[model samples]
Target chain A: MSDSTPSTPRGSADPFVPAELYTQVQQFYARQMGLLDDGFPDAWADTFTEDAVFQEASRLDEPLRGRDAIRDSSRARKKRLEAEEIDFRHWLGMLDVRPQADGSLHARSYALAMRTRRGGELDIFASVVCHDRLVSVEGAWQVAERDLHHDGSGRD
Target chain B: MSDSTPSTPRGSADPFVPAELYTQVQQFYARQMGLLDDGFPDAWADTFTEDAVFQEASRLDEPLRGRDAIRDSSRARKKRLEAEEIDFRHWLGMLDVRPQADGSLHARSYALAMRTRRGGELDIFASVVCHDRLVSVEGAWQVAERDLHHDGSGRD
Candidate 1:
């Protein structure tokens, strides 16, 4: 399922992607989101590479760099959402995956964050496009860089 | 590269996506956007399958179903944008692609709509996630269904 072999450049004549590799990448994202929505920020943070870069929509002034910073932000976000009694679900869909020459995968997807308040009033809190650069580390897919572009000026 | 061969069911042990096929799929969406941004609404609408379904953010109550409706709406949108002298660019990224058992592909990506007014002052107008279902016909990939979920209650 994992391709450890050296990859050709983006324009190479042969750019085959195995079905298993695609599925594995998809599953990796699913797990990351599941952990975040299910109140496991630490686990979700672990999905990123050690030197991961995350650019969130709300915080444009400072990008979260490295795994420790990402984990801290995730933890803070989880606490804030919980304290506000907001039940949030992050739905990721419409993914396009492209394998790069450096044995990494460049993936993009749409993200919809829906929130339910105390009275069960559900609303879409955030909509953004997530651009990710992913790398395979020890047979696992980890996010190396993620740039989130928000649809509007609002919190996700 | 286009693969006319029959696709195996999802979760199959063998799911092979040729490099050329992947490139073709990416190009299809790119062409679609190019046409729209270049003020060719009719051509952009033609990128969809005959019976395509499109659910936009502003008109949630009315989902554009079929090619005719899609074309009409696109034309109208283009006219409105042009009349207002709005320079809009739809940036799509983070695409995740999955092959379905029914020989179709499910793709999702993030979209950010940026607008510049007559004064050249740019702003992020809308952020949304686009979920798409695509199929290949005559060696060309066409969008079968698209659902745009906006981040907030704002126009994109």
Candidate 2:
């Protein structure tokens, strides 16, 4: 650990947020992605809080609320992919994590979800920006709310 | 700064990399994105090293080598976008930054590029996975090499 504070050329007011926390959040998301891609939807759902909210851009009118709803939707999606024999990979990048005054975190990142049909070529199925509000639960950061903002959506 | 090192659930060997360093790298990339989006092609080009290698998945046949080449390419791109009157925005997310043995950094993230044609609706132009090799030059992180992997490129 270096004692030096991070240099913020853009003059960020909150320059004192611990870097380790950011790393932890990055790792948390990585684990979530891994679980989702590796066919472990149940495990992935466990990463969220009991009262977490997950919203998809296309279905903003009906956001999934609570862990059960999130898990059910994930399982249904996974089942559909399996039934269709589609191989999907979700890749995430450009994570911007900020500390909130409430001791939680406001995190955002870009996501690319690609799918490949059996013996068919791969195609980008979705490109969206994920905005998340994460809270620490039992010394671990759990996503409390996630909102997906679809890029190129004129509404956004 | 907390003396306690972050607990690594996945057994990351380099858990001790300073959070400040990670924050600096994130900020560096954010600044680069801001410059490009704000139409500062020259300043954006300055984010790369003199001997940097920039490769795009769609243009692997002609990788841009050196700062001059990078700047020229960026300027040309800006000109083309302007000539066509296309409004473009690139968003990056889910950054995974790791330390290299040589004190550089190996980073990966997802990128979403959107473009809106004149009198047309916005659409996703490109979705890519960015693999970057970054180095700290003069206490600031610079892109030493960037290899973009387009997700869902059947070739991948």
Candidate 3:
């Protein structure tokens, strides 16, 4: 559902924003998330801005800062999941995208992390609200900041 | 992942489509699926054309034809889920939308159905690929036909 209101002042006067931009953002997340889930931390990290900040308030004492930090953490997580023989799939939906005045886009989406065991058992690992600040870099959208509010974490 | 190739001509000459139309289609699915998941079968069914056809080849001997039939099946499924005290959320991603020559849209997406029990236990209920033909009715998009191919069903 749309989280933005008239007070938010979208880039367009029309009720809806451009479909191409929205599609690009969606495809960006799909590729980025797919990379991370597929154990390609370097590729996934490349989708973020050099100075990206990722915050998971309930899990980490401090937000992960910069591409290096994000990549490191992602690599560690991939290794751990591999050792555990588990697979993860991140599904994002209910996106609410708003274009900012400075050319960046403020997007929020419902993120669901599903885990599947080697034995074919699957479960929802986490349900979270993802807030992202996305900017265009070389004609592609990259995440500058991502804040995750996990369900029932009481941090949202 | 875009399912369509260069052989599939989109409405525009540009590689990407109008963001407004893509956003509208996404919003339409969000609302339609949300209504069904929230137990509003009537509203969910209304999102389909009066003569809509839904095919779940693996599950049924024949396709569900017409809005009335779709509503009845949805209501029945809602009752069964209620009895089982389970919540099902349908998530769609990796959308590839192509504007057809008839002004309709041929859209394909990965669909995931997650089930959550009363005690907060959750699992991936099903993974499927969904193909849809959408038409605009009264300035809003409605499902004219939907074909679902379950993962590993050997039907795709």
What DockQ does each candidate score versus the true complex, computed on alpha carbons? 0.03, 0.13, 0.15
Docking class of 2: incorrect
For lDDT, candidate 1 versus 3, the one ahead is 3
A73-126: candidate 3 lDDT, tens digit per residue: 999999999999999999888776777789998887778988898998877777
Ranking of models by TM-score: 2, 3, 1
The residue-by-residue lDDT of candidate 2 on A1-156, one tens digit each, is: 144645653435656446577677776776577566546666778788999989886766898899998788877877787677665767776777888789888888898777766555557777899999999887767899999988677565
Candidate closer to the true structure by DockQ (higher is better), 1 or 2: 2
Superposed Cα deviation of residue B153, candidate 3 (Å)? 1.8
Candidate 2: residue B127 lDDT (0-100):
57
What's model 3's TM-score? 0.58
Lowest-scoring 10 consecutive residues by lDDT in candidate 3 chain B? Answer: B8-17
Question: Which whole-number lDDT from 0 to 100 does residue A117 have in model 1?
Answer: 53
Q: Write the per-residue lDDT of candidate 3 for residues B34-100, one digit (tens) a residue.
A: 5776567777788789999999999989999999999999878877877776667787877778888
Local lDDT at A58 for model 2: 78
If ranked by DockQ, best first, what sequence of candidates would result?
3, 2, 1
**Candidate 3 wrong stretches, greater than 4 Å:** A1-17, A20-91, A96-108, A114-124, A128-156, B1-16
On TM-score, the leading prediction is 2
